[model samples]
Target chain A: MTTVLIVDDQPLQRYGFRMLLDSVPGTEVVGEAAHGAEAVRMAAQMRPDVVLMDVRMPGMDGIEATRRIVAAGDRSRVLVLTTFDIDEYVYAALRAGASGFLLKDARPEELLAGIRAVAAGDAVIAPTLTRRLLQEFARLVPPAADGSAQDSRLASLTEREREILVAIGKGWSNSEIAGHFVLAESTVKTHVGRVLSKIEARDRIQAVIFAYDHGLARPHAG
Target chain B: MTTVLIVDDQPLQRYGFRMLLDSVPGTEVVGEAAHGAEAVRMAAQMRPDVVLMDVRMPGMDGIEATRRIVAAGDRSRVLVLTTFDIDEYVYAALRAGASGFLLKDARPEELLAGIRAVAAGDAVIAPTLTRRLLQEFARLVPPAADGSAQDSRLASLTEREREILVAIGKGWSNSEIAGHFVLAESTVKTHVGRVLSKIEARDRIQAVIFAYDHGLARPHAG
Candidate 1:
């Protein structure tokens, strides 16, 4: 059974969530918390697979509490559940290491789906929020550098290699990149490995960020 | 003198920008283009330090042209000049690797600042767009399981080290982390180093991506 915890300021809301979650097969509500502090404590103690968190809490609000709990090495995935979907607090919660973002008003299945998704390691972002986020992101330019960053680090890559790097930065894997470029998977891997070495990047994520920070890749794709 | 090329369709607009940028010290308009394709060729041939690009052009729109120019590895930094701040085109421009974003109606001085900032390697994005982008990004959840992705590899680090990894994902460096936990800078460094090695990450950037991929860091920080 997937163990879960409900953390909110209102007991009734917590009860409501518990009833919904407990009905799912092989899932159980192991504990509940009326505030962020208690949520952190119970998450640490029970090690539930998921923690349903309310964004606004008394003292250590959800963001800080999430940061602390994650810092303390609690393995449970924290899904920030709230009435508001597009607040800065939700953004802050992600920074604090939240695993999922779900609105309280979502249908019952979506809520349970978010829990399951987070538990399974898949991201669950409200779809209505994704495109808007990417659009706004297009407006945040990286630190510019009179053009040296490109020549010094990224431009050093061969033209073909740069193509692979851009695709990776867009969240495509090596196999997918091979399909796009009509190259061998092994060749794609070779280029990716070379990208990591030449740019001195550790993995695809850094390559992705490097593309953003250096202005080689934009988070929004056409 | 810093030379510039204005690439927009409107003559009056070009005349207005020329008046503004031309007034700045070490800046001048060397060329102008009314179409995206023309802008690409002009930028490549002119070798101007900056290309003030308009996103919507009759053919070969700004984003695609930006991609070709950037891919050609030219010296000009494309500062996207657009009427809409959060249009989908902006994201395309970013992915194609434009250096800056500027609203067409920004104050003359603000526009000059954008040119100078991009010319200096410091990026400029509108503030309102930045907030919305981060909210959109907060919903990303890490993949649940990949037989070969970074998550399984993260299992090698000590719990303390993982905490440090999560902190780095939040963009915290050694000193800030040290201050947070009351640990010495050296201790934080050691932890970071160990974390990097155990996870087989190439460097801090990889560690940061690993953190984000594991559902740890915010996509963009305001």
Candidate 2:
């Protein structure tokens, strides 16, 4: 069972969440906090799989609590709740290391699905907010930090590896890259491993970011 | 009714999509194109509400078609389809201004929902891709370009408007901001409108991006 700690300023809100969670099969509301400090404390103590955070809490709002809990290096992943569909607090909370946020009025199934997604180490964003997030993402994503294709880190990659890096940046899976390049999946994996090492990237996701940060991958015309 | 243009190189793929969309209520298949060039031509001529695009077309690829169609500024919104979940082509398509993407293997309902969402002017990304997207988003977002607190655009704001801008950046709803600042909601709305006009932001989303870019809103410690 996935354990959760509910943190909201309103006692009735807490009760409502607790009641719904208790009725669910896979989720268990392990504890409840009416403020951020208490939420943080209980999170540290209980180490629940998911923390149902309320963003507008009175003492030390949910964003702060999420940052601390995440920074503390515990197993808890935060799922912040906000009253509005597109709130800046949600963005702050996400950047502050909350796994995701949902509207407080999110349907019971959506909230539970969000908890499951976060508990499983995946991230979630409410659907209503995603379009704007993406638009900002496309807008704010800077061109390669060095506009020229001469970043020293990229120098280490062989021509083929560079292509692999670009493919990774494009969010292609190893198998897809393999098929596209006519390489065996094992060979593709080896190349991916080498590219990650050469680029000093922690994982494929970081490699994708690295490719975009450098000039290897770009939003090119068709 | 939502009119759609199906663009895929493969005959069977086009047939499948046409059948699915045709079978659904509230959706009408206006046309079909076998390649990017044809897709672009058809999109220009028909101006369908949504374009179901395939990325790996034989001649003119979906990404290019998406770019051209979006650049054409018609009412058509492109929803790209790929065989893989996290392809770079999808990212390129989004940057090129496609509305969103989905796996070619997505359930019929999912595809229909995506089409509806795209037609409505919202964006969509497969749920599986959102986690990685958000993670990279958090990582790649640059700190304030100026880093100092002295951007001229920001200088135009009054003290309260600056505070409102920061709150907007933090994703706070006007009501939430009002609650925190103990101001009337209408007063907060007026402040928000003023802030948006002063900063030359198109909407609240852009205001959030501006706030982050200007360092008005930060991921602060609790």
Candidate 3:
């Protein structure tokens, strides 16, 4: 069974999630905490595969707890639960080492799947949070103090492969890209698959962020 | 002068827009059409740079007019105007050769900018329409004939670049990504900038879409 932990400031939320996870097969609510401190402790003790965390918990808020949880070396994957307004903190939480974050009102199916996905070592983010995430990235992009080390991560690409990477960052489909590059559809397909494998991305969404985070892609002006 | 045409069933809308265009420098209100057929005819004759077409007009709606305008070898850009309820048809209009679509209630300044942006060959998707567009893109992505093409978009990346791209697609800030990649802040910035230039992406938002469109990116599970 996939063991899970519940971390939130509210009892109602904890109970509700506990019930939901209880209903799903292959998942069990092994522990619950009412705040970040307790969560950090329980995470270490329970050793759950997943932890559903809330953002506004008092005393070492979610971000702090998330940092603690991950830093404590517990194997548990954290999944942040939030409402739309927590827009400001979502980016910070990811940096704190929580594997993923999503809105509180996400449907039951989505929540359950998220737990499973993160447990399997993938990251997640809510759609409503997309704009906030964009703003954060934009605000932080200009002062990039992190130059000089020449990210060896990008050293693996060839020239044409880089061209296709930009196209992927532009949101083009294989067929549309085929037209843009004047290449056959099959060729574009080969390039895309190889690129993903080369980078070991969890998915395309991650690749997109990688492009932005590492400056492989810039925000398109409307 | 950037000659313009207004096409709408209502005379007031046509008149109002004509007056607006007349007030703008380098833009002239050259002709008006009460319906799509007339708009097509007048457009064929006047060959304006911009066409303000209403979506709900009778017989031969703005969509058909836009298609014909594109087919006729005219370089004129079509801009569709509609209500929120009628917004469903805007994407089709885009496919029909419309450079942009605006809401009737959009601020006056937005309307003017839409015109200039389209005339400049920039694709303008309304900010409010982003959710709707993504929903459409996600729904439409399923029937794509190229089943594995999504993964192929990143085929050219090195393993580390792919990891970096994934973080970028998630909308992470440079510091956060730098933390993840264990690189100096300057190094992260260079990688991100390189990713942007290499991918030919205009901005981070476009990079986000590119991630989703290619299936490399996805809605976070929880």
**Residue B116's lDDT in candidate 1:** 75
Q: Is the docking of candidate 1 incorrect, acceptable, medium or high quality?
A: incorrect
lDDT of 1 by residue, B1-222 (tens): 667899888888888888888777888899989988898888889888878888877887787777777777766777887887754655567657777666787778768867776676555554334434444444322333111134456767777887888887766767889999899999998898888888777667666656655655534511
The most accurate candidate by DockQ is: 2
Candidate achieving higher DockQ, 1 or 2: 2
DockQ of each model vs. true complex: 0.05, 0.10, 0.06
**Compared with the true structure, what per-residue lDDT tens digits does model 2 show for residues A16-113?**
99999999899999999988889889999999999999988787888888888988889899998899864567567767778887888788988887
Query: How would you encode candidate 2's per-residue C-alpha lDDT over B82-111 as one tens digit per residue?
Result: 998654665576677777878888888878
Worst 10-residue lDDT window for candidate 2 chain B reads B140-149
When 2 and 3 are scored with DockQ, the better candidate is 2
Sorted by TM-score (best first), the order is: 2, 1, 3
The reply for model 1, stretches above 4 Å from the true place, is A1-222, B141-222
Count of clashing pairs, candidate 2: 9
| Cα RMSD, model 2 | 16.2
